[model samples]
Target: MNAAGFNPSERHPDLEMLDGYWSDGNQARLPINGVPECFIDLDPSHGTLTLSVPADGPEPDLARFRSIELATYTDGGDVWWEIRIQVDDSLHEAYSLLTRIADLVQLENQAVAVATYQALEAYRLLLASRGGMSDEQQTGLYGELLVLEHLLRTLSPELIVPAWMGPAKEEHDVALPDVHYEVKSTKGEHRRHMISGTQQLEPLRGVPLWLVSIQLTPTTPDAGRSLIDLVAVVRGLSGHRLPRVNELLVSAGWRDRDADLYDAHLTLRSKPRAYLIDLSFPALTDARIAQVVPSASLVRDVSYRVDVTQLDFAGPPSPMDAFVEIPEEKTE
Candidate 1:
C-alpha cells in the first residue's frame, strides 16, 4: 500500500502492548524507536505522541501550531508535550501528523519547540490549498523550488524561506539581502513570461531586481521530476527547518494530501537565467506608461507579455548558484 493507505491502527504490532498499559491506571507509553525522548501512547479510543522534556526547558509555542490540541503537562518534575489525536475515524491523518512531528523532534535537541513549529507550519501550508493545486500552479511552484534548491547550496533553509516571498504575494518571488528576484516558468521556446501587473516588475528603492526565466519541457514521468518529487527533495534538505519550508509551499498552493494529483512531470529546458531588470529591460512600468501616454493614470490592472529571446541582457546562463548572502546582510 502507498503511504496514505498504511493504517497504523490495524497494522502496528505494538498497539496491543499499549493497550495493556492503558487498561491500568498508568499512562501507557511506547517509545518511538530512533527518536530521542519520544514515545507513543494509544488505547482503542485515542492515540498520542508524547515528547518528554525537562520542566525548565523551553516550552513549545502552542499558538504556533494550532490545528491539534497539543497539551503540556508536568509529571514527576518532567514536562511532557502531548500530541493527541482521535484515531477512531481519522487514523490516517493522525498518524501522518504524529509522524511529521516526530520527524522534526527526532532531528533537534529542542524537541517540543521544533515539533510545535513543524506541526504549525504543516497545517498552515495544508490549509492554504482549499483544494488541489492546478497543473499550471504546480508548474510554477516547480520552477520556484528549483531556485530554492540552488539557494540551499550555500544558504540555510531558515534564510531561504523568508527570502521566498512569492507565496506571500509579494512583488518579487525572492528577496535576498542584496537583491530581489521575480521567477517565471514557461513551456514556450522563447524567453517569454506573463507579467501580472505594473507593480510586479517595479524594483525597490535601492535593491536590484532581476527577472528569472525558467524553461520547462513536458516529459514522461520517468524522464523528469514530478512536482511531488521536487517538493520532497527540498523538504529533505530543509532539516529541522521543515516547517518554514512547508509555510512557503502552502502559500504557493501545494497540499500534501493531493500529491497524487500532481503527477505531471517536467524537465528543465535549460538552467534558469536571471536578467537584471535595468532601464534597458523590456517592461511596462507605471512610471513608463505615465511618461509615454500622459493619460495612462486612468488605466488599472495593466499586464502584458515580454519575450527576451533577442534582448542583450547581462546575466550568466546559469545564474542561481552564483547568488549567495550572509545572514547579517539580510534586511527586515
Candidate 2:
C-alpha cells in the first residue's frame, strides 16, 4: 500500500527505500527486520545519491538497495520520478557517470534541429527576394511556392526520389525523370497566354514530373523571365511527342526563326549565351526504343556555358531595373 497527496516535510511516497549496513558512502545489506517502508534525506544537488547505513545491520540485505525509487517535486507541486537500480558495488559508480552523458547527447540533438530551422528560414527569404516576390500587395505569389519547395526538400528528402523507387502513382507518371516539383506563380488577368512550354523531349519511361501553375496581378508588370517556371515545364514533359517539343520552344521564343524544328541534332540555347546549362536524357531499353521509332537514335546529353556580363542591358532605362522603383512625380 502507498500514500498519495503532498507532504511538506515528508519525502514523496514514490521514492525507493534502501536498507542495509552503512559505510562511508555505501549500503551493505538490509536490516534483519526487513526493508523499511520509507527513508528520508536531503535532495542531492548533483551526481549519485550517497546513502549510509550502519555496518552492524543484522547482516543487512544488500538486495534492498536495488528496490529504491527517488522522486522530486516542484514548489508548484509537479512531481518527477527517478529509478535507482543497484548493481555490484564496483559497477555503480561507472553507471552513474554514463547516465549524465546520455542526457547531454539528447540536448545536443535538440540544439541542432533548432539551428537548422533558422538557417532554412533565412534561405527561404533569399529565394523570395531573388524571385522578385518579396512585396506583399504586388501578388508575388510564387515566392511562397518556392519557400514551400525548399522547406519540403530540407525536411523530407525522400519525396523527390525517382518513380522506380516506388514513388506514389500520381507523381510517377509526370514528365521529367530526375526532378519532381510543382510551381505556383502570379501573372496578369489581361494576359491571354501567360504560361510558356518547354523544348525538351519527354522521357519515354520512368521520368520524374513536376506541375506548375501561375496567377497574375496588375502589380506584376515585369514578371516575365521564368527560370523556376522553366524547371517546372521541363519536368512535366515526360512521354510527350517529340514534335511537340519544337512547337513549345518555338512559341516560347527559345529558337531562332530559321532554327531547324526539334531536330535531335539542333543545339538548344539558353538566353544571353552566358549561363551554364546541362541537359539529362532518360535511358531507353532496346525494346522501348523500338516501340517509339524503329530507327530513332538516342538523344545525346547537352551542355552549354554562357557569359551574361558581356551582354549590355540595352537602353538607358533597363527592363530588369524597372521593378526596382515606381514612377515618382516631380513637385513644382
Candidate 3:
C-alpha cells in the first residue's frame, strides 16, 4: 500500500501511464523552464526531483529535514543539486516544498545564494525549526571538532566520543585517559582566547593539562569548508561510534535540520599550536589567586583573556602523545 491509500493495482488508470516510462531506473525532464536543469528521478521507493544549479555558482545549503534530503555533487563540467523525498507518507508535503524551492531558484533576478536562502527559509517554516548557533558557538565548535578529529586518529573508537566532554559541560573540552585539553579558537592576529573561569585552565591531580589554540580566518567559499561540512567529515570518520558522536553533537546544541542556517565558511589561519599548562604557564588559577589575595574565597566568576603568542612551554612534537607515558629513546 502507498501513502495514497491504494495498492499498486488499484492506482488510478491515468497514473498508470507513468508506470512503463518512469519505473525501472528512468527519469524525465520536468516542464520547469529555467536556466537550471530539473528532472524527475524515478526509483524503486519513491519519486525525486534533481535540481542542477547549472554552473559553479553558490552551492545549496545541505539541510536535513524529517521528510526530505538535500545534497549536491559535481558532474563532468557542472555542479548539480538534488532534493529527494525520504518519507512515503509525507509525499504531498515534500512535493510542495520541492516545487516551491524550484520556483525560487529558477527566477532570473535572484542570485543563487539568495535563492538558496529563501528555499531553506521555506523549509524551516514548514518543518520543525530551531534557532541557529551563534558566531562564537560556531567557531568554538569548529575548533573542538578539529581536536576531536585529531583524537580519533590516536584513541580507540569507543574512547573517542566519551573523551569529548565539551558538550557535557566538563571543565575541559576533551578529557582523555591520560591528559585533559582545553580547546580554544580565535580569529585575531594574536594567540589569545577568552577564559570563562579558573577551572578551565586548572590541571587535574596527577594529570597534565594542555591548551590547544586554533586560529581561523574568513575565506572565500571556494577555499574553505562550512561548519556543516566539517561535521560531515567527523561523522564519516566516526566509524562505529557514529551514534555516540551524534548524541554529543545534539547535546552541544547542534541539529542536522539546522545545518542550512550556517553558511559562513572559514579556513585555518595557521596550524593548531599546543602549549602545556604547567607552573610557569601564564594563567590565573585558584592557587595563583590564593597566593596574592588573603581571601581568595571571596572572589567569584573570574573571567579574563590570555595571550599565548610568546609562550615558551610547548607540548610534545606529536600532540597526541601529550601527557601519555612514552619510553625514553635508548642512545648507544
Candidate 4:
C-alpha cells in the first residue's frame, strides 16, 4: 500500500508499517522523517494529520498558530488531538522540515509540529545554548531575521550559512563564500548599534565585510507587524523557500505557538544602511583593545555601541550587491 511513494534515504521502523494503517480507515501512528518517538498519523480518506498524546503529555497552547487545524478525541478519558491538514507537496515539505526539527529537540509535547516550528526558528537564530533568552534579546533577534529575509528577497537566491553557524564568534553575522555581512538592528530612535567583540567589525585582508543596520518602530494596533505576521505571510507565499528563514526566526526566539506573546509591532523607519567596516569605521578592534587594557589582556568579551547618526558620509555607504532598499519608511 505504498501509494504516494516518497523515498527516504533510510526507512524508519514506524514508516515501514505506515501502509498497514490504511486497513483501519481511521488512523495509526508512524515516526517518519522526524524524531523516533514523534508519530504522525494520516487519514487519507479524510485528508487529516494527527499527533496523539497520552493524558499527561505536555500540551502547548496553539491558539496563535493559525495554520493548525485541531480536532479532539478521547480514548478512555485520555485526550488527544488530530491537528490535521490537507497539504500539498510544498506544505508537506514544510511539515517534514518541522518534523525533523522536532526530532532534533526531542520534543515531549502533543504540539510536536508547532514546537517543531519553534525549534526550527530557534536553530536559525543560533540560540541553541540552554536556558531562555530575554524578550529584548528575542526582539533584537527577530529584527536580525527580518533583515536576513529582506536580504534574501533582495539578493539572488543562494545557499547562505548563517553567522551563528560559523566557528564560535565569527566576525560577521552572515557568510556567503566571497563576502560577509554583519547585520545590526535597533528599535531606538537614535542610530545607535552594538557590535559584539572587537573582531566582529574588523575587516579581513581580502574579503569584504559589510555592516547592515536595520531599525524598526514599535508595533501599533493600527499599523506595524509582529514576528508572526512576517512568518505567516512569508511561509504562506514562499513555501519551500521559507525553511531557511524559518530557522533564523526560531533562533531569534520565535515559536509558532507563542506568536501572540510578542505584542510589539515594528515598522522599519528608514532604509537599512550598509557600510564597509574598514579602517575608517568607528569600532573597538583587537589592536585597539590591546593598547587600552591596563594589563593589555585580550578583551575577548568586548562589546561596544557606536552612534553613526550624524557622521557626514562623503557620499553614501559603500555599495553592496542587492542589499535591501527601503521603499518608504513608515513614521507613526
Candidate 5:
C-alpha cells in the first residue's frame, strides 16, 4: 500500500488471499528477487499488471512484446508503471498469466545485460483468438502436445525451443537454432496431410526441418484417451516451466476447465513417421513457384495436401540427438 493512497483500479483475479484487496484496496503486493515488493501489484478492478519500475526503467523497445501497453501513474517519489491487457476469466489461468510476466521481470533482473522479457508469451495469450476451434484443430493440438511430450522425454530440456508454443504463424511448428519441426496429425489412413502455406515445408539451405506425421483414429469411450489426459501429461512433464507451456496451450485455444468440451478420444494409428526436409524432399518454394506459376502473386496463396504414405523417412541429420540436430554435409 502506498503511504499516500492505494486507489488502484481493481479487476485482476486471484487476489483474495492478499489482504486489503477485499473492501479497501484493489491492489496486492508480491515480492520477487531484485524487483521490490512494492514493484509488483495487480489492479483487480481492471485486470492490469500494476508494477513500480526501478530508477533504470523497462525495456525501451517495447514493440516486440505486443498487446501490453505501458501506462504511468504518479505517486510521491515513486515512478509507477502498469502493464495493461485484457485477461481471460478463469482464476487459475489468470494467475498463470500474471506469473509469466513476473517471471520475465525476474529473468531480466538476473540477466542484467540481456532482455529476456522479449519472450512475451503473455501477448500470445492476449492476441490468441477466442474463436471456437473445430474438431480437427483440437485433434491436431493434441497431436502436437504428444510429440512435445516425446521430445521433452527424449531430449535435454535446453534443446527444445520455447517459442515453438507461440503463435502458429511461424513457418515450422517447433524450431531451434539449426533445426525445426513441422507436426501434422491426421485421421486419414494414407498418411495424407494438409500443408497450410507454401513455406510450411519449404527446406532451408543450412537448417534441417523435419515433418512428423501422427495418424490418430477415433476410439470408443472405453478405449481411447481424451485431450485432458494429454494436458495432464504435458503439465507433469513441463515441471517448473508449466506456466510457459500453459500460456502456449491457452494461446492455442485450450482452457484447462473446458478440457471436457474436447472429449474426442483417439488411438494412434501407427508410430509417428518423421521426414527430414532435404533438397530431395518434395515441396514448392518461392523460386520454384515463380518459375511455374504465371504470376508470383497468384502463387502466394498456394496450399495443398501431400500424401506422404510412400515418402521415405530421411531420418535425422545426425543419429546422436535425433530430436534436434542439424544435418551434417554429406561427403563427396
Candidate 6:
C-alpha cells in the first residue's frame, strides 16, 4: 500500500492539465474534529475530489473550500501526512469577488460627484430667474444663498433651505435651529441704521444668519437695472404711457442730454443709480449699530441675517442673462 504518504511532488499524467498543484504521495484517510467520517472519490483525470460524505456534516454553513486545507496519506500511516493539496481555484475566486466590490465603490463615488454638480447648476439657474437685482444688496444675498444650498445638498439631503418664507412678514414661522437665514443688503457708501422688530425677529434668532453687503457704481456699464428702477419701469409702461424719459436719465445721474442717448441702448426704459454700501454689522454678533457699521465713505448700510453662505453671482449669460436662443429646424 505505498505508505510514503500523499506525495504532491509526483505529477499525475492526466491531472497535469487541471492547472493546480497536486499531492505526490498516496491518498490518506483522516478525520476532522467537526466533520463526519466518509469516503471520497479522487479523480486524477479531472483533478477533483468527489466527497462520498453524507450531508450531515455541520449543516454546510461553514463548508467552503477555501476555509479548509487538505492533505493526503495511505494505510492510516503518518508517511503521507507531509503532502498538501493546492486550492488555487478557490483562491482565484475569492480575489475576483474582492475586485468586483472595489469597482462598485468607485462607480458609486463617481455618480455622486456628477449628481452634486448637476444639482448646483440647476439651482443656480433657478435663482437667477427668480432673483432680481433691482435691489443689488438683496440680489447679491440671494446669489450667495443659492451657492451655499448647493454645497449643503451634496453633503446631506436633510440640510435644506425652504424656497419661500411666505410674505416678508412671516419669516419667523419658518426658522429652524441650524437652518434659518435672513439676508439684508444695501448700496451706497454710508451705513444706515437697520431696526429689527417682531416682523424680522424670528428669522434672526439663534440660527446661523449671515449678513451680506454689496458696493455698486451707478454708471458702470455692467450694472443691471436696480429693483427701484424695475418697479418704476413696470409702473410707467404698464399703461399705454411711455416711461418718463427725464426721470430715467436723472436717476442714472446723467447731466448731459448728449449722454442721454445712452438710455436708448438700454432695453429697460429706466435704470436705477448704483450706490456703494459698506456692510458694517452682522446683527447677531453685535447689539449696537456703532459696533457693526463703520464711519466710512460711500457705504449704504443694510442688515439681515441668514444661515447659508454665498455661493454664486447672478449676471448676464449666467442663468440670469435674459436672452434665449431658438434653434432653427431643418426643412425638407
Q: Write the per-residue lDDT of candidate 5 for residues 1-332, one digit (tens) a residue.
A: 32212222243233455434524446666654445322456566665544444424444344444334566666787655555544445333333444445554554453311222543443355344433467778878878887777777766555653736424567888776777778888888888888877788886556778888788898987887788888888778776778787778877778664565778788888777788776777777776778877878665577888888887775554432454323356899
Query: In the order shown, what is each candidate's alpha-carbon RMSD?
Result: 16.6, 24.6, 12.8, 11.9, 15.9, 29.4
Residues 43-152, candidate 2, lDDT per residue (tens digit)?
A: 22222332222221122222222223233343345332223322222222322222222222233332222432332243333222222212331222232223233333
**Model 3, span 1-332: residue lDDT tens:** 32323231221122344455445545554445565655445453445534445543575555545545666777786676666654233433444455555565665456555665665565565454335667888899988988787777766668878888998888999887778889899988988999988899998876788888888998989999888888988898799889989988877778676787667889889766777888888888898999999899899999999998776535443556543233346699
In model 6, where do residues sit more than 4 Å from their true spots?
1-163, 166-168, 172-177, 196-205, 220-332
Backbone clashes, candidate 5:
7
Residue 159 of model 3, lDDT score: 80
Clashes per prediction?
0, 24, 0, 9, 7, 38
Q: How does residue 315 of candidate 5 score in lDDT?
A: 58
Model 1 alpha-carbon miss at residue 23, Å = 31
Worst 10 contiguous positions by lDDT, candidate 5 = 1-10
Highest lDDT model number? 3
lDDT of all predictions: 0.68, 0.27, 0.69, 0.55, 0.62, 0.30
Write candidate 1's Cα lDDT for 47-67 as tens digits: 443434333346665543223
State how far residue 128 of model 5 sits from its true place (Å): 16
* Global local distance difference test of model 3: 0.69
| Per-model TM against the reference | 0.57, 0.17, 0.57, 0.52, 0.57, 0.22
Candidate 6, residue 57: lDDT: 16
Task: Compare candidates 2 and 3 on lDDT and give the better one.
Answer: 3
TM-score of 5: 0.57
